[model samples]
Target: MKSILTILVFLVTFGSAFSQTGEDKHPLLTDRFIIGAGWYFPTRDIKVEVAGDIEGLEDIDFDETLGLSQGDNTFNFVFFWRFSKNKFWSVRGESFSVGSTRNVILDEEIEWEDITYPVGGEAEVSFGVALYRVFFGRVISSGQKHELGGGLGIHGLNVKASVEGEGFVGDTSAGFERSETEAFLPLPNIGFWYTWAPTDKWAFSANLDWFGIKIDNISGGLWNVSPGVTYQIIRNLGVNLNYEFMNFNADIDGTDFRGSFDLTFSGPSIRVMGNF
Candidate 1:
């Protein structure tokens, strides 16, 4: 699948390099509003450990320990709005969801909260994450074929993890044991974006965001990189091919969860865009 996407992108770039439309600028550079939707294929490495009052707990490597898939695909949506009178400012938003579930026999004893999942028990583990982001930016520099800007943004994340299986607690066996934990993290970030149009119909763009901050009882850091290409199929519609990379780590001392999570998700995405 990756090879196919690579070929597609190469073909688009090859065709656009030699083709030129009469228009002097790309439509995406001038559109007041742009909306896009697509699918995302990601490779994930997620590590988690919950620190409870009970003392002894082990860090879990989701893919290695639980047999979860390292690669998966999901739907994605993005929106852009240039709202100022002179079109020098804009706001952008994007969203996506990631999740995986697996059933495997435990190789070693695992303690989660008050329940102990013993070795040789078939356990079901599932993890899910939902991300929502919005940004406000101003174009500091621009030309007929390029635009550069930076802005402040916020990321809203809701993550949940669960384990269910036959387990034991304090020498007492529970035919069925289940433990689940969920957390909501709101992280603020700053980002920059750049776009270069080689022709009226083809453009190359990239966006980067990063931040390290402590808010309330949550200490977290985040960074994201996205580089893509766009082809204007028509005056009001286009298509996008992009590769996204994200890394986020956080520590919590709250009532819901008292542990840490370090996650990395990277993938390629293709979307359809409409302008207004």
Candidate 2:
């Protein structure tokens, strides 16, 4: 009887301790905060034509075609705070800002004095900000050590464009300028991400996001799609390699302007991130 009692007591103690330790170490999906930086490069092309005759020149033509091959690099910072994190679902709020400059080349061939004159061109810059994003995701794969998920988000953006130029007409210098126009609108975003952990203290991830906006008042829009990979150097610190493509287009407002204008940009970027 004594032996049986001692064995029963030992079994009960071991079971209780095992259960407690398992509960403490069990995998959990919980809310988290993420902060990161990103770099952006934008290349663009614009085509503008005027519809009406200027200065009594019947069938007037002003063709401004601009192309940007090498773009200016801009920095971006983002914050995402998760409200819920479950095995199969998650919700988050995000904010980010990105900006870049586009080298503009205006190729104007005018028919004047019954002769074709090639007018020189200039460049411009554009920038944008995403004020808020609300996102929802579903986890497709979840294991003791790995997670994979895809999600969609709604975003609000504020974007602006500006132009400055100096060129020639018959060996004379001329200048042109335009103020920045602001576009504010809502956009939809979709993304997928994979997270892996080789050890208890190390984790790595890769993700891609796509979003766009259409501004009716400005007669133009902007779209961006980015893919990036990150390595967690520590629990909350990371570095990333990202590549992105951004497209922009707008119309010239005056009746004197006789053509349509369009632009596009693409490039690779590098960045770093942290979670607090």
Candidate 3:
């Protein structure tokens, strides 16, 4: 009976030592799902060209013509899932929406969709963008401190634009022209991700991804880089501080409306995640 009690004490002490040292489980290694919510600040330039009987009215610059400016600060959401036990594969998705509207007096005559507005007229221009992305990636190399990978993804884009006019000089009543375009593009990308462990309590990470393609009436490219740090407060809970820079350019042509746009968004965000 004395020998049995001694063995039980030894086993309990070993288990307690292992738990305190975290020898069997690392917080990041065991993480399977992460949901992120944050804010985005975007600066943009937009131009649209239309074709019809209207001459000299085909090209419109939202900034110079109507004083449209960059998008306002907004909230964004992201989700990630890791599917490999060895941390070799994963999938991620993100979605964001941005829009802006401006009202100004026209500096020149404008015609759209068979309607003409003379100079000294007032017009309202509104533009919006909704973006979605899904990607599958593999970790080519990984260690306790670093990871590198590459993959393919599809970016879905939806654009909505409209111009409404009032104070027309002549018989053309107050009118509006609106168009919406959507496209889903597949792109192959390469990326490198790195992690640094300053201590068992904190980890710093960064990543960069880029891709470009042109086919048919669609042509565009995308690139993003982000750096972040995570602080583990306990075994399964943590907080993240991240800075992201993103840029995308696309040209689209269709039967309804044809235009080109370039947008840049850069901002810092904070999120909380749990490892399960």
Candidate 4:
């Protein structure tokens, strides 16, 4: 977090010195398509409670129960399009996924699906989430050297988790035991973005979005922000360095499972982009 703040400060300081005003003075002021791929380092915390038909069990914490690591590495990508005909309007999208699985002896007894796994038995737990988002925006304040915009977006989330072990229950033989949950959600959000260019060759941008509420059986909050600097190496190509942070909390009551899920993923990435 501190490192990201430092980059933001540098962008402001450097941009003010070289910033100029003109219609064609900034590359970002023109319409272009951008594609980028990079790496992501993430941390996660997930929990689920058993309700209704499943009773006499404690809530499950994936990190604590599965002995999952606090950190992991993954891949991410982005696609963006800015229409030249309407310099004020643009569309953007991004996607990423993270997951973990661990095999270890149970530290304590756990009950799921009306079955119980002994404290000394072997267990395997897995958790994962895939995320995708798309949005459209209109540049409300377009200046020669800077621009400000606001828009709405839809974020799609797929959450999956499972537990397997040796256990037994009423009328059931002591053998393999399994319980799992899968949820799909499409959430809408609103956000704002700012872009600054000190010169045609260099630029900086930042954006933030948030949405949350309790309506009916679904409840959760989603937040995301990113800040970055770009340097144009050639007429239609550039290199970018950025920091991204995302955190969300979800409570879903469905036929498969009833509980809550929480996660936070933050990291830095470097990528190259080309514009037509």
Candidate 5:
């Protein structure tokens, strides 16, 4: 937590250290408010390790151990607002979700949350994550057609994992429906962005967001990066295409569960944008 705080202080003051703004800017940067709704196509690689009242569990690969889809199409939304006091200062928010459920025959002995499912039995397995991010930032430097800035933010996650199969119930064989665990992780992060407009109708941008630290009962890192271009359809509207990569790794000791997981999502995206 101490390491995270040290970074918090550094990123919060990032703007004042080298704040600069360009008089000439693109419509996307100068807009007071912008909203976007997009679709993302990404491949996922997930591995989970968990135990209840037990330890030394092995990692379970979602794709190899269980038959879950390795790719998905999902919706993402974004909003940004530049403060009236300083166009160089702004706050942005983003949200997205990815997950799936599948039923398959168990290939090896499985133990999760005190329940055991022997090989050859059928099981239903599911995993999903919903993400939210909000950041406050400033433009540290700018030129006629470009701007650069860094900021601090929080990456909030809602993670759920579950496996259901027949297991012993107090020494008696019984059929079970569901056994699942959910965790909420709110982590702090630091991010930087660059935007350039070569013409009034076309603009290019790239953003990098990352953080790694141990906070209380949770420990690990998060990374999100996107680079794309925008084409203005009209004065108040546009379209954007970007390739984004996101990964999250964490170990948790929480009220509902204790476990660790690593999830990766990366792919291309297309969005419709409104600028004002």
Candidate 6:
């Protein structure tokens, strides 16, 4: 039969040139970069209450006390840039840094004071930054490989408050003064994630994050909630554990002076990750 029809047309032209050279040497979509390192703990408490008419005293009472604690440990850095690699969907750009320590305590008592005006305590150093970030994802399953995500960002803040006592009336040993505040804001974020890939190079991840900042032209506000975990140790390296809750508020007016402040922070964090 004519040599079996020329051996079935040379086996269908060598199987279509080996499936088009394995789809041009394997390509679907790719672009990613990430780098990270972390640890930041911040704690602050402040209270200020002033009741009207200071220069013209009718019923005047003023009270203030502030304490800031930053667990003596700080360092955090992050950078990420990724665009489109549909595990479901993806987009990213991020930058981060945080450091802490600010403590202040002051007390003043008056009614023509038998004598009580002490401002003998001080410490300062606090910082925050988030340039830009926008990310998203979703892939419920890749046969037991899961994923989910959400995002938003933009933030900047700086703080410094220092006051030392025994110098309100006369001269003494511990007398020093400092007060500083710088803020720029527009931050919003949301997150939910779960990932696992127990084989093909190993992976594990978890996340929950909520973030906020409102400056309303200096009627300040900041909020945060965080939970995190990650481990890869290869294929790009990874390690993380984070827990955080933070809130800060402020209102101020100068020239004739006016003030209001509040702060709260909680912690536990450790991180190191890289993917490219």
Query: Which numbered prediction scores highest in lDDT against the true structure?
Result: 1
lDDT of 2: 0.51
Q: For candidate 4, lDDT tens digit of each residue in 1-276?
A: 999999999999887766654346556557477777777776666665555456565777778776887687778888888864767788889899988888879887766656777787888888888999998888899876788999999889888887788777754757887877788877788988998987887899998989997888889889999999988878677888888888878777876657677777787777777776
Model 5 agreement with the true structure over 142-188: per-residue lDDT tens digits: 87778899999999988888888887544566677577888888879
Error of 3 at 121 (Å): 2.0
- Tell me the lDDT of candidate 6: 0.44
Highest TM-score scorer: 1
Residue pairs that clash (backbone atoms under 3 angstroms), model 3: none
Structure candidate 1, residue pairs in collision:
none
Q: What is the lDDT of residue 264 in candidate 2?
A: 52
lDDT tens digits, residue span 1-276, model 1:
999999999999998774667756787788899999999999998888877655867777777788889888999999999999999999999999999988999887778776788889899999999999999999989998899999999988888888899978768997797888899898899999999987888999999999999878889999999999999888888999999999989999898798889889998999999988
Sorted by TM-score (best first), the order is: 1, 5, 4, 3, 2, 6
TM-score to true structure, per model: 0.90, 0.53, 0.74, 0.83, 0.86, 0.28
Question: lDDT for each of the candidates?
Answer: 0.89, 0.51, 0.68, 0.79, 0.86, 0.44
RMSD for each of the candidates: 5.4, 12.7, 10.5, 5.6, 11.6, 16.4
Output the worst ten-in-a-row residue range by lDDT, candidate 1.
16-25
Question: 1 or 2, which is superior by lDDT?
Answer: 1
Query: How well does candidate 6 match the true structure in TM-score terms?
Result: 0.28
Off by over 4 Å in 6: 1-143, 149-220, 225-227, 230-245, 250-259, 262-266, 269-276
The lDDT ranking, best first, is 1, 5, 4, 3, 2, 6
Clashes of each: 0, 9, 0, 0, 0, 2
Cα lDDT of model 6 by residue, 1-276, tens digit: 989888888888765533332221111112166667777564434333222233422211111223333454556565555454554555444443443344444443221111123444333323333233344644444443434455544334333322323333223332433323334333455555555444333344554545544444345555656555555556567676776665655555443324444555567767787776
Worst 10 residues of 4 by lDDT: 20-29
lDDT of 2 at 250: 45
lDDT of 4 at 104: 79
